[model samples]
Target: MHSVQNTLYVMTPNAYAHLDNATVRIEVERETKLRVPLHHIGALVCFGNVLVSPALMHRLADEGKSLVLLDNSGRFKARLEGPVSGNILLRQAQHRAALDTEFALTAARAMVAGKLRNSRSVLQRGARESADPGEAETLTSAADALAASLRAVPGAADLDTLRGIEGEAARGYFAALNLVVKPQARQSFALDGRTRRPPRDRFNALISFLYSMLMNDCRSAAESVGLDPQLGFLHAVRPGRAALALDLQEEFRSVFADRLALTLINRGQINAKDFDEREGGAVMLNDQGRRQVVTAWQERKQEEITHPLSENKMPLGLLPFVQARIFARTLRGDMQGYLPYLAK
Candidate 1:
């Protein structure tokens, strides 16, 4: 299995990257700011306006590392990788399963089960922490709704039925997400529901940014295991969509991103002032806000958690890679079935 390692993020707008004596050198305003050995990094993620020298890019490819480019607000722009890794047979198995209705349904059920279970956990935690009786009741009810959805997954007869169950659980989860925010901060950070394609609120913007980060991590994990990240059973194939990566992302969206976003807002590390409203009523994080969120995100990735299935403690950053490896094993017919990551 591929191991998880450090992911270098360059969020500064003017930062330039190049190779200097087998190390990645970062410079801004013509002054060297940081230097990291290439061997220590798993990926180099650069945000808006960061320039990567050809020499550095070639060296990273040679070292089997990834170079992911994102806009300032954490939108995925592009990704550069070395030669594809992993066994060809594994990918062939993945493709065959993707086109099989039974295989797709099984895999989708595992993924959506993980999502609902984690979403329920988030709501349960919120209910426990909430002082307001009404808010606590609402959160508990949502958690129950998610639990019902989880029970319904195995009974889903078709793709559309499974999607309907997933959508209902998501709506119930998001409705309770507002209670995750502290009462005093609700006016500034109320989350009505999930929104994308230019999020309409600060809460949605934060969720989008976090989802983008998770997507990149999932893509890297899939590539590391030699799986085609673009071909997935849960998500339909579409032009330029990383379907497999997205399918993997569903499990972690609640446990990782949603939890962190709540921590940031409830703790007052992020506030309304950190967002900017653009034309057409779109909302997004400003530069300072992005930096704060990214730094916190990196630190959060370092935190360790125990895997329920493997029963091993590992860094949070390794979760996606571990799940990908397990999924690959299932596709290869080495395992009986896929086991989604379950939060305790």
Candidate 2:
């Protein structure tokens, strides 16, 4: 399996991409800039006004590579992918399993439980490492509350009730997010309970960008296992929503994005100066800030971690794909139950 997590992000505006047989060529100002073999690319993310040739598109589709387009501000615009792989039988199984009441509830519980546990782990680590005793106490209390919610996940009777439990846990987790930031940067990087849509604060802006990147990874993972990204047990499906990807991403938010965001801020790799405030009080990352975060995120993905369920060590970038395969096995009746990744 060509499981390399090589995502080529074309950030330069007006960069041209084309296919030279099995090679992907990039041109800027009528001069060749970069060339990569097709097998090396898992996904291509184009930002701003980059142009992709038809030949390249054909090659990407044939090889099952995803092409995602994002605006300059790092918001998702669209994605292009080839025909769905895997047997229709697998998809049928997925569709049926999603609609089955018992199966749906089971899957939902696993996702919520995994998210709560991972979130609590993040808080516990912060509590242990934070210099401020008051902040440590706050984080510890929030972690205990999230732990309680994790225990309640299995007993929820319906999807709505399960959603309520998950929401409460998430709220509790974010409520303590401010305590995770160092006191030196607390005034600038303070999180006011997870605001979004415009991301009023600098902290929320960075978090939203990290989440977009994580969601893309989950989408690719779900597709690789022949599952429909739009259908999900934990999230309600609607037009233009990759519900399953969102559901899968919840388990990784704390361990992946949240930790990285905190590291960037506390270590001063990114600060208030990296953010730009618009007239409407919307905060966003400047281009330099975006590049810094992308570089850090790519490095973070390369770090090794042990899988709690499989007891196998792997790069953090490959976690989503591993979990997707596990979910597929459960849906196909090969596995007795689905186990969501819980960070240790």
Candidate 3:
């Protein structure tokens, strides 16, 4: 049996990396050499001041490997690859399928349904954990109706109809948020429109920060796979918004973001202590909480998942591959409809 490959995680305050005589060198106070077999490296997640050599960059370019960079504050700064083949037909195919009434509706429904289902499950789990069965049943019904509505929408012509359906689906999920989180006082996100500086409350700040990172990954991956990162059926395509990424992220809202948020709250891994109340109605996470959330998120990305279409196990890392495959299937006319990935 082949061993699973480990993603190389370079965490440091400051460092320089370059190729020294064909060997990859990671230099700080002292130099360490890593003769990384290209196949052995699944991805690169760099935390703070880690440098990449031009030679190493070229090598990754040749192999088409993934590089995810995180700043000290846990902000995702850049994604290096665009993953375009420079073929006009391919680009046209992506745009056509993305905008097609039937295809877009099919893709949108699957994803929207997946998100609704997960939302219900999260509510149920949180309810059960808190010893509340009433909450669970409420969530179960929400899941049922959301699924029904997804199938019910026959032929959505534009983004509005799709969003109308999503609105219906969301009612069931949000109804349970108050039940899950205790209501000593209501916390506000106070987004003067950007997440920056000393966060108002550690918990809310952690959620936004982590969510932003996930959003970047989803958008970058969708773009690399040749999907229009800006056009999403379930989400409105506004200025600077990555709707397609939002669309692809539906199945993961529960599996990735929401679950992490709940876990952090439940495990007492993070709490009110980690947050601060800013004068401008903003909330933020302290340094310790920031580290905790980013670490957990990285581990979550490394979690292995089974591909719904391929029936082969892969990491959440391959969600992009999965996205590209389904879109390609629609273009090639192989699939009657595309289904978003839902874990059993």
Candidate 4:
């Protein structure tokens, strides 16, 4: 499976029969179609409108593929096999072990700071392509501020410190973005904004969408490793919060999502028509917009990049792989730390 490029995505409003083609086919639909390849599938995500065939239900229990179902609101409804059946005592110990101050702080800092720095890295790259020199300077400055915050994170005592750094970094990043997108009155991004019609102004909308995709990718990685998604290190343990998913997503929000968003904009892969402010107080991507985003995300998954810690070859698209490895090590007691993945 490692050697195989076996990620298949299907998004169809119309019904279609399942083909006996790939090992895993992620079907996201409003209703059910044919029998799902549960044994073959590695993961599945359905957003609101989906009806599962009886065979697929049975396969879920037997094959135990990474099955995750979400409601219309995108909250996790059901998971096929997310819990461990190992010795209760060992599992309890692992859970408690995870709460130690050292482990907690290390993981949280790495994720938060990684995300902030990656965002800076992406913005700087985008700045290079900005049409205006002033805009580029602002972006570079934002990137620098974010970098400084990231460097000051190792000694952060609590989540509040992490949050402060994150906030400051975002402020700088957004300040620069406003300049890049100012000429386009229809486009803008602000740190302080509500999910209104055009949930985010053109610029912010794209960034927010990119952020969502990044979070999903990180969640997928954490789920694959069988860790409790709610027991997070950085974010507070709120009810129904995918705390661990939030934690994992921290490192990726910028690394994957921001990079993709900029590429789409600079390459002319997406435009204003891709967004819709149809409803009041909320904005969203049109079907075409979602399609384009997913295509770019999938393309990102296929690209390879270097690992800063391992100093070995890994996928640029393998943010999940990198994350899963971190979790696996933490669980096995092989490593006493969780390090954020960084570029060489």
Q: What ranges in model 2 sit over 4 Å off?
A: 1-4
Local distance difference test, candidate 3: 0.63
- CA lDDT, every prediction? 0.89, 0.88, 0.63, 0.61
Model 4 ranges off by over 4 Å: 1-8, 14-39, 70-94, 178-198
Cα deviation of 319, candidate 4, in Å: 2.2
Give the per-residue lDDT of model 4 (tens digit) for 6-34.
33333343322233333223233434333
lDDT (10s digit) by residue, model 3, range 1-344: 01123456565556665656545556676656445555676556676688887787776666676666767555666656525453456567767776677676667766776776666566656656655567556655665676677575555555577668767666655555545654332242122222346544444466567666667667656655566677776676697667777777777766577678766675666766666566886565655555667677776777888776677887775675576567556656777765666655
Off by over 4 Å in 1: 1-4
What's the candidate order when arranged by decreasing TM-score?
Answer: 1, 2, 4, 3
TM-score of model 2 (CA atoms):
0.94
Best by TM-score: 1
lDDT of 2 at 100: 93
**How do all the candidates rank in terms of lDDT, highest first?**
1, 2, 3, 4
* Best-performing candidate as measured by lDDT: 1
Q: Give residue 288's lDDT in candidate 2 (0 to 100).
A: 77
Better of 2 and 4 by lDDT: 2
Which window of 10 residues has the lowest lDDT sum in candidate 2?
A: 1-10
lDDT of model 1 at residue 240? 90
Model 2, 226-298: lDDT tens digits are: 8999988899989999999998998999989999999999999998888999988899988777878888888
